[model samples]
Every structure is written in C-alpha cells, then in structure tokens.
Target: MTREEIYSEVVQILADSFELDAASIKLDSTLYEDLDLDSIDAVDIFVQLRDLTGRRPDPEVAKQIRTVDELVTFVENEIAAAERGDPEPQPQMPPGAGT
Candidate 1:
C-alpha cells in the first residue's frame, strides 16, 4: 500500500481502537503525549500493524516510534524490506488464536 493509504489505515486504527477523534490526529501527533496512548496501547497498535503488513517490527525499532509520521515511515520501510526479501514475511495468525 501507498504511504497515504498507510496513514489512513493508521488513523483509522487509532480512532477505532482508542476512540480518538480522527480529525485530531496529525503526522506530528505524539502517540503518548498527543494521542494519550500507553504501553499497552502501543502493543495493540503493533499487533494491528503486523496484521496489516504481514511483517513484525523489530522491538527495539518499535520503541523509537514517537509520532504518527514515524510510525508510517517505519511501516513503509517494513513493506519495502519485505518486498526486497531481506526478511521474509511470516504467515498471519488469527487474532487471539495463540494468546
């Protein structure tokens, strides 16, 4: 998916998952400060992102994501990396199936 599409999906995830106002989300919005996300919320987002992109993000890299823009860029890079076969995409499992 394109960057714009990815941004839209991210916005939707935030709105749907956290009940935030979509209009309030901006590229510079800080996930914890502006969006009021906690660590658990961040994990939820990562799970949704994995489901969307079919790739898991490096935990260390995921920690550095602070804003919506950074999250989008990370996802874009993950998609590109998958396409390049640097790390093969993993099979997706249904949500809650393993947990």
Candidate 2:
C-alpha cells in the first residue's frame, strides 16, 4: 500500500486502540508523550500493525520509532520489502506464549 494509505490505517488503529480522536493524532505526535501510551500500549500497537500489515517489525527498529508518521513509514517499508522477499520470515511466538 502507499504511504498515505498506510498512514490513514495507522491513525485508525491508534484511535481505535486508544479511544482517542483521530484528529488528535498528528504525524509528529509522540506516541508516548502526546498520546499517553505506555510501553504496553506500544506493544499493542505493534501487534495491531502486525495484523494489519502481516509483517513483524524489528523490535530494535521499533525502539527508535517515536512518531505515528515514523510507524507508518516503517510499515510501508516492511510491506514493500516483504512483497519483494527481502525479509526472511522470522519466528514469532504468540503474545504470552513464552511467558
């Protein structure tokens, strides 16, 4: 999907997950500070993105993500890379599977 489409979906996911107004989530909005999202919320966002994009973003890369725009861009790149077979499938345990 295009970046704009990915961004729109990301906004919807955030709004639905947090019950925040979609208008309140700007591209530059900091997920933690502006959105009041804790670490667990971040994980939930990642999980939702995984479901939406069918790709798992690297946790290391995710640590550097600070804004909604960044997340959208990351997903855009991930989806494109996955389509091109640039990303090897990584093992994933379902949430709480290891704990």
Candidate 3:
C-alpha cells in the first residue's frame, strides 16, 4: 500500500482503538501525550495494525514514535519493506520519521 493509504489506515486504527475522534487525529498529534496511550493501548493498536495489515511495528520503536506522522511514516516504510520480501525487521527510524 502507499503512504496515503497507510496514513488513512493509521487514523482509523487509532480512532477505533483509542476511542478518539477520528477527525481530530492529525499528523503531529502525539500518540502518548495527545492521545493518552499507554503500553496496553500500544499493544492493542499494534495488534489491530497487524490484523489489518500483515506488517508488525516493533513495540520499542513504536514507543518513540510520538506523533501520528511518525507512526504513519514508519508503518508505510515497513509495509513497503515487507512487500519487497525483506525477512528481517528493519531498523527503527527516530521518532517523527524525518519530518
């Protein structure tokens, strides 16, 4: 899937899993600070992410992905890598995903 699609999916997942307003979710919305997500919330989100798409984001790296933009970018890159048949997990990019 493309980056735009990934971003859309991320928004849906976060909104549903976190019980937040989907319309309020933005690129720079911090996952923890803005959404009040904890470790269990993170796990639920990741599990939903995996269920929706085959790719899994590393929990450790994901913790550092503070904003929606970073989360979207990371999932986009990881999905692309998975489609390319990369067997191993990719290295974690710093939060904000170069934005």
Each candidate's number of clashing pairs is 0, 0, 0
Q: Order the candidates by lDDT, highest first.
A: 1, 2, 3
Segments in model 1 whose C-alpha atoms lie over 4 Å from true places: 88-99
Please write out the lDDT profile of model 3 over residues 53-97, one tens digit for every residue: 577566677777778898787787677767897665555788777
Worst lDDT 10-window in candidate 1:
85-94
For residues 1-99, what per-residue lDDT tens digits would candidate 1 score against the true structure?
A: 999999999999999999999999999999999999999999999999986677877888899999999999988998888788776434577777765
Tens-digit per-residue lDDT, 10-76, candidate 2: 9999999899999999999999999999999998888988876678778888889999888888898
Candidate 1 local distance difference test against the native:
0.90
- lDDT for model 3, please: 0.78
| RMSD vs true structure, all candidates | 5.0, 4.6, 9.2
Model 1 root-mean-square deviation: 5.0
- Cα lDDT for residue 72, model 1? 94
- TM-score: model 2 vs. ground truth: 0.86
The alpha-carbon deviation from the true structure for residue 84 of candidate 3, after best TM-score superposition, in angstroms, is: 1.7
Error of 3 at 41 (Å): 0.5
Model 2 residue 97 distance off true place after TM-score fit, in angstroms: 16
